[model samples]
Target: MDLLSLDFLILAGVMLAAGAATGVLAGVFGVGGGALMVPVLFEVFGLLGVADQVRMQLAVGTSLAIIIPTSVRSYLGHRARGAVDMTLLRNWAVPIVLGVVLGAGIARFAPPSVFMGVFVFVAGVNAIKLISGTRRWDIASDLPGGLLLRAYGGVIGLLSSLIGIGGGQVANIIMTLHGRAIHQAVATSAGIGVLISIPGTFGYILAGLGQPGLPVDALGYVSLMGVMLFVPTTVLTANLGVRLAHALSRRSLEMAFGVFLAIVSVRFLYAMFAG
Candidate 1:
């Protein structure tokens, strides 16, 4: 395909527009926006004729790369509001990174169905909780510390890496269920995105290194083209999401996110059973 052809230009425009939406989602939801980006990137890669074997990995890896900057931008925005829990982040850092490494290694051989399963299970459960107005049901009076907390971090990182996310959905639900305020949960989730995406990106890169059927200019599974098209727009629009997040009531935000998770869950469920 001609790099400057009309068809390619149209897809490029689509990517830019998607990036803008992604940035807003990242900021508002304290996510890395991979839940949105993975499916979009999958379609784009398919249209671009990436091989079936490698296209999913490419999408996953590229989404992680894109999240690095978007997560940072979103994290900074949330941190400025004095809502972030630095202590939790500090505790989770090593475990999360280690889990990311393990997950990325698994990604090298896992099928798309594996990822979809993880997404459907987690997102579906969270969707039900948030949409049913049970988001505040306390699993504990407060978050656990020591080994248990680190285990949660590891799980979050592992799942996020597998599914190309920034770990927000898992972290947010965990925090909220432990009696943390929704605002603090969301803010802390943004920081988790930062921790997940950086090592996750490198892990995917290393995992896909020397793999076959990769697209041109792909750094391992990470698509440079997708990253290039996505980063600028996502970075520009992140602040808009942050502002919107702070303006909404906690209940409103929870409901919105719940709806979003519901949609994501249904989409993947269909893909899993019907596809």
Candidate 2:
């Protein structure tokens, strides 16, 4: 756990590469990088000998902390393109925060197996939807208002926090179903990641406070080393992802995202069963 040690240095380098890759995915898929980061962090934590009981929590928290900056960068990039839907973001913010707090509390008591199961399940669902090209499917012409909107936001936040994701997949699905354009849905999802990460990160910290077996230099469950290693690289590469997102056709992006989700889901499922 020594920050200056060779092991930590090597881990940092690995995490830097992971962060760069995650940033591009975040920009392209609006997923806030957690879908990728959590699994990688889980493997790294295991290698570092993090205690089994706290490893998942640390990974989830650290992923959210890293997301804050990356989400902001992606949001800015999308905004410049006039793709973001600010009204939706504003309407959903409060409920999303509330749900994130609840999710952090749940994560504090939930077993790692439960978190892994949830990740696999959610990723599977997302993969199926993307691959099926269901973006135009709709339950309504516009998003639900008032109580329904709050409920939807809460669900998005709850699920995202559980899986350490940015809630983009869910948000994009909902928005597109409600008649939003694919590009707009993606852009707004980046903003949702910012909302989710800010509150979710603090909530995890509070939830993990005084918990046992956390790695060194941890703020509650949030790994300072992970944040240090991840943030800069993600920020630097996110713009490149945004450019790619703009270049690709909507169908191409959807297919690519589907393939990525399938890979991630399989990885988590294998980890869950193998353990």
Candidate 3:
């Protein structure tokens, strides 16, 4: 926790770099920060030798904490440009928030070995599907029923909380396949992520039960190290990414991020399954 400690300084630097990168990616992809933060956190947890018991929860919680700021930054630009769907946001956010809270609570006590195995399997499957071009962006929010919508949101929340991701990857695919426009789906999912992170961070903090050596100035499972180092960088860089989004081709950026996601997913699979 000491600012002058060499370990803290080094971790801060690494987090800053990852935060900036996440900003650029968010700007380009119209998603929250976890696309980049999750992978980085996984590696950080591994390096820190955090116990398997809570490492996954910490990573997920830390990713959600970063999302609080990063998603707001990404959404501001979209709201200004009228890309966000306020109606859809209102319709789904409540259920999604509830889902995130419940998911976080469950993850806090679940066995890490089970979570990691599932994480690796899902990431690998998602990556392969992307590589095959079966998961390209589109638009569709066709929830067959209100019950299904809540259930889907809950499932996404569960997976997201378990993995420390924003859930945009799955949300986007689900929405677009149902007939929602890609941009609208991206924007709305950002709103859902905001809901997920705000409640989910608190959930993990409460569930963490105050593990020791959690680095300096930490809040339960959410790494104070990552949140402090990454949040500001993410906000600033996300603004820049927004500008770039307006100037560049949105589809191009999305495609690029897709490839990046596959690479990161492979890394995650290796870290969990191979480890």
lDDT for 246 in candidate 3 is 63
- Tens-digit per-residue lDDT, 64-132, candidate 3: 889888877787877888878787677677777777777787786666557556655554554454445
Name model 3 segments beyond 4 Å from true.
1-8, 45-52, 111-145
At residue 148, give the lDDT of candidate 1.
98
Q: Which structure is stronger by lDDT: 2 or 3?
A: 2
Ranked by lDDT, top first = 1, 2, 3
Q: What do the candidate models score in CA lDDT, each in turn?
A: 0.89, 0.86, 0.71
- Scored by lDDT, model 2 comes in at 0.86
What is the lDDT, from 0 to 100, of the residue 64 in candidate 1? 93
TM-score of 2: 0.90
For each candidate, what TM-score against the reference? 0.95, 0.90, 0.83
Residue 44, candidate 1: Cα error in Å is 0.7
The candidate scoring highest on TM-score is 1
Clashes of 2: 0
